[model samples]
Each structure stands twice: as C-alpha cells, then as structure tokens.
Target: MTRRTTLNLPQLRAFLAVVDAGGFSAAAAELGMSQSAVSHAVASLERELAAPLLIRAHPVRTTVLGERVLPHARMALSAVRSVEQLAAEATGTMTGTVRLAATPTVCQGLVPGLLRHWREDQPLVTVRVFEGDSSEVSAWLEDGTADAAVLIDPPPATAGSYPHPGVQLATDGYRALLPRDHPLAEEPAIDLRDLEDDPFLISPNGCEARVRTIHRLAGLRFSPTHRVRDLATLISMVQAGIGVTVLSEVSRSLIPADLVLLPLKPDTSRRLVLTGPQNRLWHPALRTLADSAAGHLAHTASCTAGPAVGQPLPSRSG
Candidate 1:
C-alpha cells in the first residue's frame, strides 16, 4: 500500500505563522504554542512534503519551496474561514476572527472606537488589526492576508470589480501644524502657498500623495525639507520649530497641547472607508462591520459634541 501525503490546517498555519512573524519563537508566541511545538510542526510538514521549506536563521527566511507554498497555504486558511463564515451566516450568528488592515493614523485615531462598537454589536466576532502604510494595507487585502481594510481615499471601483461599494466611515480635511510662536500661527486659516517659504516637514505615511496634490492645487512645489516616517517624529520636528507640516484633522486627538493646529484655506480632505476583498467573497462579519459602521457614523453625526463623518470640520481658534 502506498502512503498518502497529508497536510493539516495546523501544519499550514505553523508554516505561515513562522514566515509572517519572522521566526519560530515569535510565531509560537503569536499562536500560543511552545517554540519547540511550532518547530516540530514545521519539521513534520517538511518531512511529509520531502523538502525543506525554511532556512533556519536568526530571522527565519522561507526557502523557495516555502515561497511557492505560501499562497496555497493562505488560500487554504481563507477557505476554512469562508466555510465557518457561511455556517455562521446560515445560523444567524456571526463568529470568526476578522483580519482587519488599516493605516497607522486610522489605527490610532479611529479603530479603537470602531472595535468597541464591533465588540458590542457582535460579541462572538474577534477582530485582529494589522496596521501598515496605505500600500501595505492594500497589498494585504489583495493577498488574502486581511479580510477587510480601512482604506484612505481609495479610488472608485472600475467596471466588473468588487460589486459591494465601500462604506464611508469618516472624512477629515488637512490641517496645518505649526509652532505656537510661528508667524502664521495666529491666523484663523493659512493659505497653503503662504507656507512655501518655510521649511516643510512631511511624513510619507500614506498621505504624501494627497499632500502633493494639495500643493499642486495651490500652485506650489511639493518638496519636503525632511521625509519622516513616524508620526511622532513628524510632530516633534514641528514642535521643535524645525519645520511646519500638514496632517489630517483626525490627528487632532494625537497632537500635543503645545502644537497649534490651524485650518487650511482651499481645503482638501480624505475619505476613510471600510472595504473588503475585491476578488473573493467577504467574510460575513466584514459586511456586518461595514453596516454597523454606517449606522454608528450616522448616529454620531446627530450628536453636537464631536466631529462627524462627511461634514466640514468644526471651527477652532488659533
């Protein structure tokens, strides 16, 4: 009798977890397994396949075989989730882990509140957030690493693309950040061109393109004195009077008391939306989250105290 080669979800998940987390130890921690157990799983998988999948190193690197196997592993896992989702849908109880991707800003500014609502609305659903730049978030969605994502100013779907439209979560215009003592800090609102003479600090954190567009619209060059990657670093540079910068008004919550946030004249804004996979059927929890977000935003819109989605920002003193 010939022996049958076998693969199981645990083995596949172990392989993927090591590749994604960059090491067996980290992957074990993520999966709540012992490091040796995770290693054993991968080794067993390699034995079953009769090939090496990963190079053992400080940070594990996938062998060619592993690279080839990754997509199939992801697909297998995604299919299992789909089956679970379908069952949950039929039973009228949403339950599963949703891998949600978001840009750093959205993760910091918006996701906590959104997660709170999800926790209450669907108690059985668990959301695991992956925070990255816009490009990384989009790529994760494409590769099936994430079931849903919070997209920033995503372009309109072309013909024959994903049928379900993205649900808008929030809209926020750009605001200029300056040292309290800067010359333009006292103005109610400053024109974009007015800051052309000063050194500009910008973060390439998923908003650089929009900032360039705003500069182009204002008839100024989009050159930056420094391109900072971290939001905290960018805010620090402005606070130290190194340069001024613009950020989404949603970032107001993250700004310190010392940095002055002023409105920009001839304003440009970005729309944040909850979106799901374009090529595959969405996990039912994702659709529920989108609907819940729409209703939550609508409810928030009626309240007077805070900013609302799709509305002009409330005025603030300089």
Candidate 2:
C-alpha cells in the first residue's frame, strides 16, 4: 500500500483562501484556480490532518479544527511579510512603536503638539509616552522601559556623565513664567534677580533640583508658596497670584490667562534633551516624535496662556 504524503503548500494556501473568501468559488476566483481545484486542496488538507477543516453551509465556514490552524497560518504569513519588510528596510524604513519618556511639562506642552504634527508625517510609527521626573526618566532609560526621554536637567557635564552613551539627543535652556500683570511682564526678558521676593512655585522633589540649581546660581532663595507635582498645577498657582516659577520655554504654553513668559536673564537655561540607549535600535516613530517636540518648542515660545488653565495640571518631567 502507498503511504499518503503530508499536506503541501498549495493545499494550505487554498484552504486559507477559502477561509478568507468565505466560499470555495470565491477562493477559486481569488487564487485564479478552478473551484474544483480549490475544493480538492481543502479536501487534501483535511485528509492530511484527519479532521474536517470547513463546514459546508450556504456560506462555507471554518470548522473547529480549521479555526485552530488559521491563527498559526496567519502568523506564519505575517512573519514572512515582516521578513520581506525588513529586507526592504535594509536601506532605510521606519516602523514600530517608540517608547518615549518625558517630564510632565514636556509631556503636556511639547509632546501633544509634536505628536499631532508627526502623525501627519509618519503615520506608520506609534509613539508611546511615559511621564516621570528627570531621575525617573533616567531610570526608565537605564531599565529599558523607554526608548528615549526628553530630559530637562541631564547629568552633570563630566566624562561618562553629560551626553553619556545612554543619551543621544539635543538640549535647550530654561525660561521664566510670570503673571501677565506682574512687573517683570513688561520686560522682554528678566534675570533671576528680577524675580527677587516674588512668591515662587516649585515642582516636586526630584524634578525641582533644576529649580534649586537656578536659585543657587543666582545666590538667592525662593520660599515657594506652593509645591506641585505637575506643570499645569504649577502654572495654575502662578496664575492665581500664588507666585512665579521658572520653566522651560517648551512649557510656556502651560501659563494661564493671567500669566506671561519671559526669557531668563543672563540666559539661564535648562537643557531640553532627547536621550536614548546606545545599543537600542532607532525607531522612525521616535525620531518623528523628537523632531515634532523640537518644532513645537519653537512655536510654543510665543503662545499665550489660554482656556486650558485651571484644568488639572498635567504631570511634570524629571
């Protein structure tokens, strides 16, 4: 007696077509084969598996056995397509998710607008945002939880410190946020000395280190009337006449209707940086997000605080 051979590619392909097309005739049309040929393939597949692979009703449907095999078949097809894509992308193609971390301020002010613009340009890439303080963001990068981060205060400038292999991105300086009615509002820019005696609002502990540095540099101390965790809340306090706060120009939009933003005096600035691991593969989505963030930061410098005020302030970046 001759032994029957295992299922062949043609049989599997035809079965898949029938399952997708919902009928043998339709599958035959799609596969450019005769209906009988298509049916023969399905029969062969079923015989090899020793189980019915389809239920023949008015509209044919997959049997339990067919359903079980369908997923594996689909996954196999997907893997083939992915391999082809990778081959095509050998020259260059950006796809997949880019996990990004940022302080609350960067997340609220920079990321939203940037993502809006980036979606139009690179629709294939998805950017997942993680919000935390600078320290937390650093930790996330170190732990492989995020692909990159928008850091406000990077590590100190020393060998193996600033611009570490773990961080590869641009940086920017800080700006000042004040009430529109405040005295400093009239100046095109003001120095830290200009803010003397003003009621100050500071961010939470880890993230506030930069604010502390700013004060220390100017040889002044601000008794913050309010300490908040998020940029929106901190800006709210500034709007309520609670006090003034210094923030990145990227977060200038967070100012309330009652507030205004001014460039810092003597040009004290925080580094707005994009950082990612040295060994991590670069995703097109992440590059788009970072570029969008940079562009939005430029436009946001002139933004006036609008109705977004009094809303629950967004989270802050570390």
Candidate 3:
C-alpha cells in the first residue's frame, strides 16, 4: 500500500507566501504570523514530502521540485475558493474578492478607471491589484495568484494564443515622450532616425521588447544610453532633459504637464486585454468584471481620450 499523508493548507500557504514575498520575514508579515512559524510550516511540508522546497538564503527562491509543485498548489487553493464562492452564491449574496494582475503602466493608467467602474456596477465584488512586470503578471494569472490580468498583444489563433476567454479593453499606439521645449517636440510626428542623435532611454519594465522591435524595423541600432526599470525614474530623467523614451499612449494620464507625447511617423500599437485564468476554473467575480469592463467601454466610447477598444490601426509591429 502507498503511504498516505494529507497536505495542509497552512503549510502550502506558508510555502507560497515565502516564495512570493521573497523572504521568511516578509512572508511572516504578509501572513500575519511569526517568521519562525512560517519557517516551521514550510519545514513541516518539506518533511512530509521528503524533499526540500526552498533554498535558505537572502531573498529565498524555490528549488526545482518546488517549481513543479507550485502550479498544483495554486490550482488546489483556487479550487477551494471556487467551492466557497459557490456556497455564497447559493445564499443570493454575490460577493467575493478578486485578484487582478497587471504591469506597472496598466496598474497606473487603466486599473484605476476599471476599479471605479466596478465600484458602481459590482459593489459587492472587491478587487485586489498585484503590480508586476509583464512576465510576472502573465505567470500569476496562469498559476492562480491572479484571478484575471491585463495581457499585452496576446496572439489571436495559434498554439501560443491565450488559453482563456478575454476581452480587449483598449487599443493604443506608442508615442515618443519628450520635454515640451525640446526641438523635436515642436513636430507633429517624430521619426525614429531624427532622435538617433539624442540620448535614448529604454524602460525594461515591460516595453523594451516592443521598443527593440521598433528600432529594428526602422533599420537603426537599438543601443540605449540608460536602461531603467521604474517608469517614474524614466519620466524624471526625460523631464530633466537627460534623455527621451517611448511609451504607450495609454499612459498619457500619468505624464507630467511639462512633457509632450507625439505619435511616431509610423504608428506601432498593441492590444490590451483582460483575461481570466488559464489552468483553473474562473472565479465567479471574474465574469462580472469582464462584463463590467465591456459595458464601461461601450458607454465611454464616445468620449474616451485614448483610442477606442478594438479599433484598427496602421500596419506595424505591436
């Protein structure tokens, strides 16, 4: 007979928390438990499985076996939550928490507006936002840390296409960000070659891939004087006349008043879509949020400052 040992939810939670928070102390703070308790829980789990899960070091990371186990843990937890949500639905009270993930720009630019809309439309549902880089955001959705997420440029139909149902929230193109008094700022549209002489900055937070492609298509070297991770830092550097960068037009709201954003000579656009989980059943609130998003876009279509959702644009790389 095979040995049977029941897995504990708290232990699994402790393990996941440590990995996500980056350390035992941080995980303890996040889970409202002592550091020793968190560590003990993980140790108990490791002993039960007869395998080590994490490397004990600064900013602790998962071992190879832990990586294989994490997705199963996430799915198990999500399934439990779904059962609880079903019970609540039977009571006629439509209320639950949703974890939504997004890149830094989407969190700052689009999430606030969606949350505002949800407040009025689905008052009982609470949304928690997890801000991460694009890759992290995608992984979170797949692993159930995020019930839904905003994906950039998801493929239409292929093996690599998004696996879940999604709705396109907005379609916007890239624009060059420059100081208001800069020489190129006077022009209606700036060509990539014209700015080659100036110091160019690239934000690797999520936009670097598209920026590299833009340079390659323009037949120019993709060298940047600086590679910054924080959008605010990049904006500050550009505002101080240190350099210039390109960003999505959706982020116009976050731009300072002294900066001017102009379209490129040849437009490059990307689609932003809100999608549910890929490997787990959708949380009840996930569908509600998607519906609310669709309604919000339809109502705001007439007066939205950015490009309309799903509108066609010029042929260019996303």
Candidate 4:
C-alpha cells in the first residue's frame, strides 16, 4: 500500500488571503483569523511546497513561484466553489470571485460605486479590484493575474489600428482641468493654444499615447512640468495650484472643489475598453457587473454636465 498525504485547504486559503490582502496582518483581518495563525499557515504551506512564496516588501510582493502558483490556486478554488454550487443548485444561489484591474483613476472614480451595486445584486460573488497604470493593467490581464481590465487608449491592436477590437465600455472626450482662480478658468471653453505655455501636470510616461495625440493634434510639444501616475494625485496637485492638467470627461468626478473642468477645443476623445482573454466565457456575476457599469455610465452621461467638476467620469456607455 502506498502512503498519501491530503491537501491542506485551510493553509492554501491563508496563503491566498495574504496575497490578496497584500500582507499577513491585512489577511488576518479579512479572514477573521489571528495574524500569528495566518503566518503559521503560510509557513506550513511553504514548508510543504519547498519554496518561498512571497517577498516581504511593502505591499507584499509575490515571488516568481508565487505568481506561477497563484493562477492555479485561484482555478482550484473556483473548481471547489463550482462543486459547492452544484450541490446548492436547488437553492438557486450564485457565488464566485471576479478579479478586475484598471487604472487608479478608474478604480477610484468609477469602480467603487459599481462594486457596491454588484454586492447588492450578487451578494455571494466576491469582487476584487486591482489598480495600476494602463500598461500594468494590460499586463495583468495578459498574464491571468486579472480576469478582465478597463483600459483607456488600449495600445493599438496593430501599430496603427484605431479603436482596437474587444468590447468598448464607454467613450469620453478631453477637458482641461484648471484651478478655480487660474486665468483660463473663466473661459467658456479652452483652445489648446491657451495651454501652450501653462505649466501642465500630466500622466506618467506609460500613459503618454493619448496625451501625445492631443499635443500632436494641437501642434505643440507636451512639456509637462509634473508627471504623476494617479489621476487623483494629479487633480490634488492642480487644486493646490501646482499646474493645470488635461483630463477626460470621465475623470470629472475626481476634480476637487477648487478646480474647474473646461472642455478642450477640437473635441479629442478616448475610448474605455473592457478586455479579457478572447475565448473565455465570463462568469454570470462578471457579466452582471459589466452590464451594470455600462448602464450606470450611460445614465450619468445623459443626466449630468458630462464632466462637471467634482464628479468622476462614468466608466461605461458613450
């Protein structure tokens, strides 16, 4: 007779919680377990796997092995949940996890409300949001770390394809964000030339494509005085009078009370795209989420100033 060892579901659960929460302490709080117990579970798992899983960096970086194992673990968990669902089919309950990634701006301005709505509608489904810049979000989807992503100016499908394929969640035009007292704030609308010499705050290098397009269309070089990664940070800097920045109508919700959003001349626009693996069918809960996001954005656009100051841009619908 051959000896066999059973899999430790509790230990695996603890490890996944730590990865999702970004640290042992947070994982413990989320799982309602003692921090020491969480740590011990992870230690036991590491001993079993014979590999160090996570790096002790702030924000809890995952090691290469951890990254490789993460997707498999998620899949295994999903399978287990599916079995439970089969057993509970007569009860007509839905439960699973959906992982989504997006730019910090979208995460802050649009996703929170959508997630809240999702929780109300699908009480059993867990939604996890990951925030990063455009490139990082795209990479997350490609690598299976995220099930889907919301992206602006998705890299051209080819070198020059406009409005790349996949599903479009929404469309928004650009605007100039200015401090309330700035000279250009009183202008009913703004021309690109008016911003030529203005000190500008802009998205970091990874998000330069659309910004570059605007600059190119305006026939000016984008010489931003400050480049930041998060839209909220850029808006805060603008509110503090550091510099004016260009923003999308969708970003209007993030504008501070002291800032004003003026429409840009020539009507430059961007598309928000929801992307995932081409062939995989989305879970019903995720489909509900995407539909809700699209509906909310449509409702917001039709009823509001489109990009009024102090309001976040809607994430879906034109």
Q: Determine the backbone clash count of candidate 4.
A: 4
Candidate 1 overall lDDT versus native: 0.84
Greater lDDT among 1 and 4 belongs to 1
Whole-model lDDT values for every prediction:
0.84, 0.66, 0.82, 0.71
Question: Which digits, one per residue and each the tens of the lDDT, describe model 2 over residues 112-227?
Answer: 75568667766776777788877888777664556678765455333432123222222445778888888778898889887888877888743476677787888887467778
Backbone clashes per model, in order?
A: 0, 12, 0, 4
Compare candidates 2 and 3 on lDDT and give the better one.
3
Candidate 1 C-alpha error for residue 91, in Å:
1.6
For candidate 3, the lDDT comes to 0.82
TM-score versus the correct structure, for each prediction: 0.89, 0.56, 0.78, 0.73
lDDT per residue for candidate 1 within 169-195, as digits (tens), equals 787789999999998889999899999
The predicted structure with the larger TM-score, 2 or 4, is 4
Clashes of 1: 0
Sequence-dependent TM-score of model 3: 0.78
- Which residue pairs clash in candidate 3? none
Candidate ranking under TM-score, highest first, comes to 1, 3, 4, 2
Worst 10 residues of 2 by lDDT: 307-316
**For candidate 1, which ten residues in a row score worst on lDDT?**
309-318
Q: Highest lDDT, which number?
A: 1
lDDT of 4: 0.71
